[model samples]
Target: MVPLKKYPNYSSWAFLAVMAVGALFCSTVIAGVTGQFNLAPVGIFCGLLWVIGGALCFWAVQAEQDLAGTGLRSMSVSILLSFFSGVVIFQEPTLLYFSVPAIACMVIGIWIPASKTKSVWKNWRSLLSGAIFGTYLIPYKFSSLGDMEFLFPFSVGVCVGSVLLVAIMTLKRKKSFGYPKIPTLFAFASGILWMLGTLAIFWAIADDGMFGYAVGYPLLQLNLVVNQMWGVFVFGEYASRHGRIKLTLSTIVILVGAVLLTLSKM
Candidate 1:
């Protein structure tokens, strides 16, 4: 945990900037190496949406202390929304028998952790963040470029968005942009890591990839499992027996839902 209080003067925008810079660098490198440098308007749009959504996600993470809750709320919502978008808008096959219950379990999982939180504003932010993260990939569906090819434009959008954020914050707060060195490095590393994961996701959902949008998208939400593990073991979250029980139960239910979703596509 980067002691939030220790850096009273740290700017969130500064952190976001470094992270975006890292992502930009990674994406540029990958695109160059793969020779996948096709640009499209939709890709740019996806990047812009990611900027807003990613910012909200960063804020939600900072505001919410429970890492599991943060992952569950945002990711569950993202899975549900993206699943439906794949089915309804993209005209993907509908496996109601499995999907209905899967959705129910996910909703239950989201509700359990969400009910524990006292901050209404934080809840709203998490929900909004999930909404954006969920739908930002829609434009990719329409683009003619390969998954790897879309990364460069998408990263450019992220960089542009970061710059806009820094400018806005500087002007509004009347303060220069600044951040602690360690946090900046961590943020940059995180961006590189995120870009790597994002590449896999893009490949998974690509038209020629192993899984199409409906299947690949929901399967990726399994990341919540890893997120929860960090919360429980590393962060010592849900230390109380009751909290642990709820976390375990919710996670099981969510996983069950995810399993059913996987089967639904078969």
Candidate 2:
């Protein structure tokens, strides 16, 4: 694979850290409450929390936000890709059903143009990293597992894939390979976290609505926000690294969004 064209900036990376934290908290909390209380109310509350919190994130971060380009483009990519969550969450949805379309949109939305400057191999690498990264970050539909139904297999898949991605990155040694050594651990952590987190949320939501509804839904946004930020910033992503301020602010927005949602739940 040819080396990707070099860039002068990497400020956006900060946001990824922000989003990861959000995913952890929100998913954990939501699981706690919904598993415990099983409240229909929790979902409704989350809906409201997300709306206001998302708006605030947009307000704080989008100074030059435009529909046609830059901010909108990346966000659009994230949304479209995230839309796969619906597929995963739906009852008995297959991997390809959700994965294919989501992957395609991501390719069109971000990868094609990116390919112009970078090699095809690098583009594919980004695709792999991003897809996995996104998976770990979101509130996936397939998050559930019936009694004795799906825990071991799921964990096996996660551990395998994570190890594979790392091995690929190491063996391939593609110059523009997006993953960082340690940060990629977060991706693995996310996979394991999602599995355990899902069960935890499942249990918690049975007793804890505040933790479930308020913390979980907004936390979804939080995870995605940082996921998007980091995926793009560290490895490769929707936008090329513009500068530090953009990255930092984007990161801040993700964290704040999670915080706001969690608080509103209270």
Candidate 3:
């Protein structure tokens, strides 16, 4: 097993990521036979494939040994999250929710990291994917299908999952590639946690979009911000570059922005 302390170089991580993609392709091929047209199967399948890919990736660069505890935990969490999503169905939105702050949440949820990490706008790619995810949980042509309000939860789950994965992968990647480094993958897991919870939020929103936005979004975002601050949950951010004081200030600002959003929505 590769020691966590001994970072694996970027080339090795990239190899694993590429292999993960191939695994995704392989899973996609397998998913074709399944009667379901939803992306849930593919997404859940990809989660496993990433694990296999990560393991293979690990083996390729390091010695032949089982993956580490943290890696195993991460995979387990992802699997559980996807499994939870698979059982639930996405419904249409019944309430009205949309505005600048909502847009800001969506943007910051995806953008902040995009700028700091790799591609800032890359989260948008998951729009279709997230929609697919939402569709699976929700019945087709539901009464509120035209509302599109519930898209927030679905999209957040997708956006967070996509970017956070990239972030975590980078954290584990060794320094050979020269990309900015994170000390550990522990924090990145928070993103996964929030994503998992979002699955519920999407399903809930499908039932009642307003509550989902006013209640659900705030709960989720608050949890997320807390995780970001704690640095123990998934994708937690520290105040290194921004500094502790600055981070605190930013949190307050975001909270205020979130409150404004809640008020506007209400």
Candidate 2 lDDT over residue span 29-50, tens digit each: 5445555323233233332233
Which has the better lDDT: candidate 2, or candidate 3?
Answer: 3
Best by TM-score: 1
**Tens-digit per-residue lDDT, 1-266, candidate 3:** 12221444433343333333333333333334543223333334334333433433344323322122122222222322332343333322222244345435433442232224433133322222222332333232233332223333233233434345555766776333333335223223323433345445555344444544323433343443443443422233342555444445545655665565455545
Residues 1-266, candidate 1, lDDT per residue (tens digit)?
Answer: 13222243455567777888999999989988988775577777898898887777666666765567777778877888888888888877758799779878876875665544386565676778888888899889877888877888888888888888888888998978777687778778878898898889899888787667776787887888788777788778778888878878888888888878777777
How much lDDT does candidate 1 score?
Answer: 0.77
The alpha-carbon lDDT assigned to residue 124 of candidate 2 equals: 33
lDDT of residue 155 for candidate 3: 35
RMSD of each: 2.4, 14.2, 13.3
The list of candidate 1 runs beyond 4 A from truth reads 1-10, 117-122
**Can you give the lDDT of residue 142 in candidate 1?**
76
RMSD of 2: 14.2
- Say which prediction, candidate 1 or candidate 2, comes out ahead on TM-score: 1
In model 1, which residue pairs have backbone atoms overlapping below 3 Å?
Answer: none
Stronger candidate by lDDT (1 vs 3)? 1
